[model samples]
Target chain A: MSTVVLLTLTGLGLAALYFLVASGLALVFGLADVLNFAHGLFLSVGAYGTWWASGNLPGAGASGWGFVLAVIFGVVCGTVVAALVELVLIRPLYSRTIEQVLVTVGLSLAGVALLQASWGADPRTYPRPQWTQELTEVAGARVPNDRFLLIGAAVIVLAGLLAFLKFTRIGLVIRAGVEDRSMVTALGIDVRRAFTLVFAIGGAAAALAGALGGVYAGSISPTGGSSLLIFGFIVVVIGGMGSVVGAAYAAVAVGLLQQFVNYTSPGLGDICVVALLAIVLLIRPQGITGKVATS
Target chain B: MLRIEGLSAWHGEAQVLRDVDLFVERGEVVTLCGRNGAGKTTLLRCVMGLHGNQTGAVHLDGDDITARKVHQRARRGLGWVPDDRGAYATLTVAEHLTLPPVVGPAPWSLEQVHEAFPALYTRRASPATKLSGGEQQMLALARVLRMGATVLLCDEPTEGLSPLLVQQVGEILRRAKALGVTVLLVEQNIHFATTVADRHYLLAEGRIVGHFDNTDIHSREADLLAHLGI
Candidate 1:
């Protein structure tokens, strides 16, 4: 029973990380129609940003409100980078699908290489609050407190994203744009602005995930985001491209399945995930929620 | 209040519109009549800035807007009701009605829109995809009217609608004209066009071939219908 409880909690923590990365990916793809391969780079930027701020920023440290400040800084950095990418790179190649994909793929590779050059290839110990490193007993099992933090953060992000989509004017434009972008523009709304906004939002969320993920794993590396990004892509595909709620559900399924299967056989978890993806594709090609533009 | 002078458009290597010139005065309802591939839809797309392979001058209220973007043209008081109705799958009816910014001075209020379109009012909370075809068409027209478009570029507004719904659409277009909205319509329904439009331009092979008022149309109704292949 304790083993089950521990596995469940751990799986949820992993799910939270996947949700953070996939939600942004879905939104960017849904609204902009740009398959942004550099999304992993955004996550890396966030993780590295938080790590750097904890040591270098005057008011930020590894614990308490200082850690919170560092996370904010990292998110802001990611947001700025995302917005810049949309303005400078993606905007110029609008409506050129192949070109956009190639540019993003090239950017992802170049971004990682740049990071490796600057920070070296070694994994660095991530600075986290002392409390997160400790554990709390739950259901006769010792569960890491970071699991709760990850779950809590994911819940908040999910709620916040839903509210943003539901109640805001930009949200309305985004929803409409996803359905028919040309129609939205015919209504006189500037959809390119919405594109930039989605990129920023996606960046912020991915960065938050990067920061939280480093804490969960106890270390951060330049390639860390790319590694998690593979799962992120799987989660997005399983959830449906552009649906946040779907991402959350798929993340939970993937994470839990991986945790349970990996426990039984050392390296079978990843293969199982691929099998699950194939089964899903064969059964429902549009994904669990269907690709209906952020619904 | 709207004019196009020497407009020419192309799709890659093939030219579609050729030196097209037309105008609609303030509060006038004009119809562009053509057969399939006669560049009617392409003309509307060019005016709305949706098509890029174009050259010539599009003047809205005597201001050259040839280089304006789609949103910019829309913001300049050109409301478009596309043939497809352009309803969103995710947005509700109310959201669709309220999505476009009010660019003109005499835009309809929510109360006015609700009074004008009671079906839309009842289905206000429903997603646009859930609405029937007639309802979607009505919602499309209502959305533009709510935005208070000074010049409406409506393409095939009555296509595929029932006789009853077509009458409703005609009534709405008449109401828009009464409210001082200039309209440039592309329609195959000649009987409906004569009832709502002041004048018509016959387009063939991408150029304006003939112009007629209601009386001229009534005299040459059969010939015009045969020409339009309707």
Candidate 2:
């Protein structure tokens, strides 16, 4: 009973982090039709930015204010970098799928190399504030205080994203643009600007997730973003390529599956995920909630 | 208030539009009549800045909008309703009705649009893909109206629509004309064109081959039909 409770809670916490990262991936794909492989690069960038920000603070990682500032700065930095990348690199490659794939993949490689050169491939520690270090018993399972905070943050972000999409005119335009780019442009809306904004938002969300996940893991490595990238791709593929809601559901499902498998057959956990993905593809190639291609 | 001078467009290496020159004054309804593959769609695309590989001058309200971007031209009061009745499969009819930012003076409100096309009200919550062909056409026109466009460019507005829907579309175009919206329409339906347009320009093999006013439409109907091979 305790083991189940522990696995469930841990799975849910992992799901929260996955939601933050994968939602952006789904959105960027949905709005821009760009498979941004460098999304993983943004994750590492945020983690490093947070580390630097927290280290610069008065009490370093020990200060609550320092931790908060680091997280905020990390997100902001990610947003700015993503916007620049969109404007300079991705914008010119619109409607060129093969080129986008090549360019973004190359960008990911370059980003990882730059990180290695700058940080010397060391696994650096991320700041965990004192509050997050506290532990409590929840439903007979030992729970880290930060896990609840992560879950809460995930919920808040989801709610905020939903509200933004539902209530705002820009959000409506973005949704419309996602459906028909030419129509949106013919309607006189700047679809390119909308794409840029969506890309930036996706980057910021991934960065925020990376900062939190790094703190949770207690360390961030240069290759840390690569594993999350694979997980992000799995969640998105299982959910749907361009579906934010689908990504959230898939993230939780994958997290739960991984957690349960760890208890049952640890070595086969990765195989189980691949098998499940294969089954989904065999049944619904477009994905669980993806729109069918017209032709 | 829309003019195109020396406009020529190409699709890759094959030239589609051959130096087409046309103009529409404010409150005039002009139709560019042509059969399939006559470059009517390409001409409209050129006007909308969708066809980048083009040599032309498009003047809107005495402004040289030749080099202007699509959205910029749109913001400057150029509204287009393409033949495909451009609507997203995922967006609701209400979203299609409300998403476009209104540009220029005398824009139509959501209520006003719903009033004009009551069929849209029933499908407000439905995705655009779920709407019938006629409803999609109505939504496309409604979208342009909401944008407060001074010059409305419509491509094959009556294409693939039922006769009843065609009549409804004509009514909408007439209403738009009464609102002083200068209409440059690419149409194949002669009866529908005669009903709404003040003048007609016959296009064939990508060039303006004939021009007829409403007064000349009746006498030259047979010639025009023969030219269009109707």
Candidate 3:
């Protein structure tokens, strides 16, 4: 029973991480129609930004309020970078899909290389709050405290996103833009602004994932985001393209399935995920929600 | 008032509109009659800044707006009801009405929209795309009215609608005209056009070939219908 409990909690923690990364990817794709391969770069930036801020920023450190400040700094950095990317790189290409894809692909490759050049390719020990390194007992199973933190954060993000989408004026524009961007512009609303906004939002979420993911893994590396991004993409595909709720559900499914399968058969979890994706696509090509841009 | 002077548009080497000059005065309803591929939609798109491959001077109230973006053109009180109705799958009817920023002085209130389009109010919570074709058309027209558009560029507003719905659309157009909203409409239904429009322009091979008032259209109805291949 304890083993089951541990697996379930651990799976949920992983799911939280996936949700953070995939939510942004889904929104960016849904609203902007940009595949945004450089999303992983934003994740890496957040992880590294938190790492740097912990040691360098005066008000931020590895623990307590200092750590919180560092994460906020990281999120802001990611947001700015994403907004700039949309304005400078993606905006120029506009409706040219092929050019946009190539540019993002190039940016992703160059961004990682630049990070590796600056920070080195080796993994650095991540600065984590002491409480995160501790353990908590749940259902007779000793679970890492970071698992609870991850789950809590994921819940907050999901609720916040839902509320924002439901209540805010900008959120309404985003929902409409995701459905048909040209129509939004035709209605006298500037959709390019919404595009930039979605990019920034996606960046902040991915960066938050990056900062928390470093705590989960106990290390930060240049390639860490790229590796996890594969699963993030899978989660986005399994979920509907632009639905944040769908991404959340798909993340939980993928995380739990990967955890259970990997436990039973060591290296087969990834293969199983691929199989699951294939089955999902075969069954419902539009995804679990069976819609492209719906919330 | 809206005016287009020396407008020429192309679709990758094939010219769709050629030196088309047109204008709609304040509180007037003008219809552009044309066959398929005759650049009627392209002209509307160019005016709305949706089509880029065009060289023209579009003026809204005598101000040159040729360089304006789509949203800018919209902000200038040019409301567009595309042929497809342009409804969003995710947004509800109420959200659709409220999404566009009101740029004009006398935008309709939600209550006014509800009063004008009772059907839309009843389906306010439903997704815009889920509405029936006629309902969608009503929602589309009501959306522009709610935004307080000064000039409406409506493309095929009555297409695929039942006769009853067609009458409803014609009534709405007449009401818009009465409210001092100028309209430039692309329509194939000549009978409906004559009922609502004050004047008409016949477009052929991307050029303005003929101009007529209601009396002229009534006298040449069969010939014009055959010429338009309708």
Instruction: Supply every candidate's count of residue pairs whose N, Cα or C atoms clash at under 3 angstroms.
Output: 0, 0, 0
Sorted on DockQ, best first, the list reads 1, 3, 2
DockQ of candidates 1 onward, in order? 0.78, 0.50, 0.72
Highest TM-score model number: 1
The chain B TM-scores of all candidates, as shown, are 0.98, 0.98, 0.98
Q: Which candidate is the best by DockQ?
A: 1
- Off by more than 4 A, model 3: A290-294
Maximum-lDDT candidate: 1
Q: Chain A TM-score of model 3 versus the true structure?
A: 0.97
Clash pairs detected, candidate 2: none
Better of 1 and 2 by DockQ: 1
Native contacts conserved, per model: 0.92, 0.80, 0.92
**What is candidate 1's CA lDDT for residue A289?**
88
lDDT of 2: 0.85
TM-score of 3: 0.94
lDDT of each: 0.92, 0.85, 0.91
Q: What is the lDDT of residue A128 in candidate 1?
A: 76
* Pairs with backbone N, CA or C atoms under 3 Å apart (clashes), candidate 1: none
Interface RMSD, Å, model 1:
1.0
Residue A214 alpha-carbon offset, candidate 3, angstroms: 0.7
